[model samples]
Target: MATLKVLGAGPVKRGITQIAAEFAKASGHQVNVEFTGAPTVRERVFAGEVVDVAVVPAATMDEFAAAGCIAPATRAKLGHARMGLAMRKGAVAPDLSSTEAFRRAVEKADAVVANLANSGNYVAKLVGDLGFAADKVQRQPDAVKVMEQVASSPQQLLGAGQLPEIRELIDKGVAVELAGPLPDALQSVTAYDAAVAAASANAAAAAEFTAWLATPAARTAMAATGID
Candidate 1:
């Protein structure tokens, strides 16, 4: 059986994992998928890991293509991830209908928690732009840890991460409630893509798997996982 190594970010992780399982069963290939922060994904690529396919932010795909790590022509966008907020369970969910309201909410919160990658970076800048001290933000290395901090905190902390991840945490009873997406004006969306590695000996198999990721069945799985 052909084995494909895949690396990617958190937003599409659940969907991608499910897709990989189905792909393996149908195509008779083994897929080893790893999901991490976007920056780490880039680091893995730059370090020359034997990755057959990479599913990361679209912008990262450009970087990988420029570095000749992946075939530019094979890039296929999977989906977009929107930034969102999560508040402790039993806490009042704030109105985030506008950028002004979001700013105000952040100002009133006792503390704000966010992962230092992806959506968290955007939240950091938004906090700074809103006149909050950048250093005041609790920056964690990963979304799961960020939510863990928020869930265990007694203070009113607002945690931020990619919407899909936050939703997953809520489903898993992380003591957080979905406070909705960031206001449209300050909203950040990341489009994820999958591309075959340029150095892959399994290019044909990798290409087929990546192509299958864009099919209707895959989309259905993505939607079910809150990726879309």
Candidate 2:
């Protein structure tokens, strides 16, 4: 049996963790995953961090392959997740039925909380394009922290991040609930990809895990956590 270390983006944490457990059970391999923002994943890989597998945004994975951090041929698409909103549990959910409604919701929010990840960056730009002031947005380090701020705040806040991440925190009793995904016209879906690291000592086991991520069972697990 071999142990495979996986470094993944925060948005895919729940789905990847579920798939990792299933793979570990069937293959008798110990799979450990560290979840953080995509930028942090790239930074770690570039800094020479030794990892067996890496899962991040598809574009970032391509960058890794080009930089010789991960094997290009081993790359596989995981899935995509849509950006969504969350609010403290029991709070009146915002009207995200349409783009205009979304604009009104943001305009009425006491504060807009978002992570400093890809999803957050997109939402920040969308809000700006809608003519909202940048100062109204409070950016956190990651999704977990973004939810933490929303859950702890007494003021009415709109938390923005990947739906899977928002759902994960809500399921963990984080005092938050999904406010619904951004209105269709204003939605953003981020695609994710996984690959075995070029410097991995457990490349074979890592490859097995990455390949299994596209299997039927893995897709089921991913969908259960909001990953499309």
Candidate 3:
């Protein structure tokens, strides 16, 4: 009953699409959820790509709305997300139950991959939150590159994963056991939101889908996909 063109950043993209598919099945409509990092999503939107709704990071969403890409008033603050650290499955998962342990893990780690835009901000915030601001390790801006590097490297660190994505990434050659888990304070959530594009062709449908995202059914789907 609906068709939504949405944009999302990494970290929770796999979960995002899984939930979107479920929503589509329930809504009796086709939902096309595009997955990309915050930077690429911004690039696409800013470059004038056509889309109906978006579920990017809260900060990026606000900027897009302010820039007239998304309807300012149509914006709704979604919930938060957790950025994690993943290693090779056979290796040791980092001890990140605390700030100190997280720092140790990152310091002792080999390679670190993170999104340069939204995920990067969250990971950076997490770094600062974990008192590792001085570490000065830069996470990559692209998710594919991050995934590739981690898979090839025996010891790699990933900075995203809300659950099923983590599981999927692990299956896709992510260094699960070799890398580690997300940090403690780094466990901060990124508030996701929905908004209609000002130039959308189906504003009503977009609004309906956005509203659906906040429903219990949607939340149930999101939770099932590892979104908070």
Candidate 4:
């Protein structure tokens, strides 16, 4: 019964947490995961923070493979997380049926809240391209905080984050509700990957856990959390 230490990206926290429990039950291995922003995950791994596994955006996993921090052969694509919008629970759902409607909704909202992560950066640029004032987008440290800010706001602020993050907050009844995904043209999908650390003490168990991420049951669990 070896314990595996994992560093995972925040956007996939809900799905990964669920799957880690399932994996632990089936394999009798204890999986401990620390979740944070994708950039921080890369930074820590590059700084030689030792862990049995690392789960992050696919591109960052590529970087880790190149840096020899993760075993190339153990890397597996997890799933794609799409950008989505959320509002305070009971707030009127905004019209996101088309690009123009999305723009109008953004224009009318008191503010657009987003985290300082990959999905938030994309949304910031998106609103900028739409001619919305940059000041209208409020940036927070992470998705959880973004949802919290929107949920607590008395104004009609829209929260932007990875779909899974938003869905998790809503499922937890965090006083926020999904307003659907971003418009097709304005959508951004981030693919995630998981890999065993090359220097892991429990390499075999870590490899087994990473491999399980691609299983059909795991995929279904991820999809239920909006990680499809």
User: Which candidate has the highest TM-score of all?
Assistant: 2
In terms of lDDT, the poorest run of 10 residues in model 1 is 116-125
lDDT value for model 3: 0.66
lDDT of 1 by residue, 34-146 (tens): 99898899998899887899998888889999999998777877888888899988889998999889988898898789886767878888899889997658899898999
Better of 2 and 3 by TM-score: 2
Cα lDDT tens digits, model 3, 1-228, are 557788766455665576667767766767788777677788888999889887787888879877888887777655666666666555666777787877787777753566576556666666565556435445665655555566566555544444445656666665553244565654656777778888888888777777766777667666665566
lDDT of each: 0.88, 0.89, 0.66, 0.89
Better of 3 and 4 by TM-score: 4
Off by over 4 Å in 1: none
lDDT, candidate 3, at 172: 67
Collision count for each candidate, in order = 0, 0, 19, 0
* Per-model TM against the reference: 0.96, 0.97, 0.79, 0.95
Stretches off by above 4 angstroms in model 3 are: 1-3, 22-28, 122-138, 155-164, 171-183
Candidate 4 per-residue lDDT, tens place, 50-78, comes to 89999998888889988899998988788
TM-score of 2: 0.97
| Model 1, CA-based lDDT | 0.88
